[model samples]
Target: MIKAKITVTLKKGVLDPQGKAIEGSLSALGFEGVNSVRQGKVFDIELTMDDKATAEKSLTAMCEQLLANTVIEDYRVEIFS
Candidate 1:
């Protein structure tokens, strides 16, 4: 079996309203050093296939197809057994 960890985040130039909200909250809570915050999504997927290559390919396809908005988001896939 293989496990894939997919991390999805907004592209660097994209505006992250959620992240900005969190940063504002942190500052309000007296986190003086809080300069910026970026929010992202993580998905842990377990695959029956044991081959790492195949699992990676499948995970990438999943991200490209539905897990991520390719136009404004970037994704990284990590596979482990």
Candidate 2:
């Protein structure tokens, strides 16, 4: 079995309201030097595979189809056996 890990994050220059809300609360709690914040997604996938090429291809397809929103988010995939 192969373990695939995925991360998805918003691109720079995109507005993140959830991050901003968290930052605001942080500042209210006396956290200093807080100016900006961002948020992202992480996913772990498990599959039965042996070849790296096949695993990578499948992982890529998964990312492109459902794991991430390519229009506004960037993604990374890691495969381990």
In TM-score terms, candidate 2 sits at 0.90
Q: Write the per-residue lDDT of candidate 2 for residues 1-81, one digit (tens) a residue.
A: 888889999988889999999999999999999878898999988888788889999899988998888999999989887
> For model 1, how does the per-residue alpha-carbon lDDT over 18-81 read when each residue is reduced to its tens digit?
9999999999898898878999999999999888888888899999999999999999999877
What lDDT score is found at residue 62 in candidate 2? Answer: 89
**lDDT (C-alpha, whole model) for all candidates:** 0.93, 0.90
Off by over 4 Å in 2: none
Native-structure RMSD, model 2:
1.1
Clashes of 2: 0
Candidate 1 wrong stretches, greater than 4 Å: none
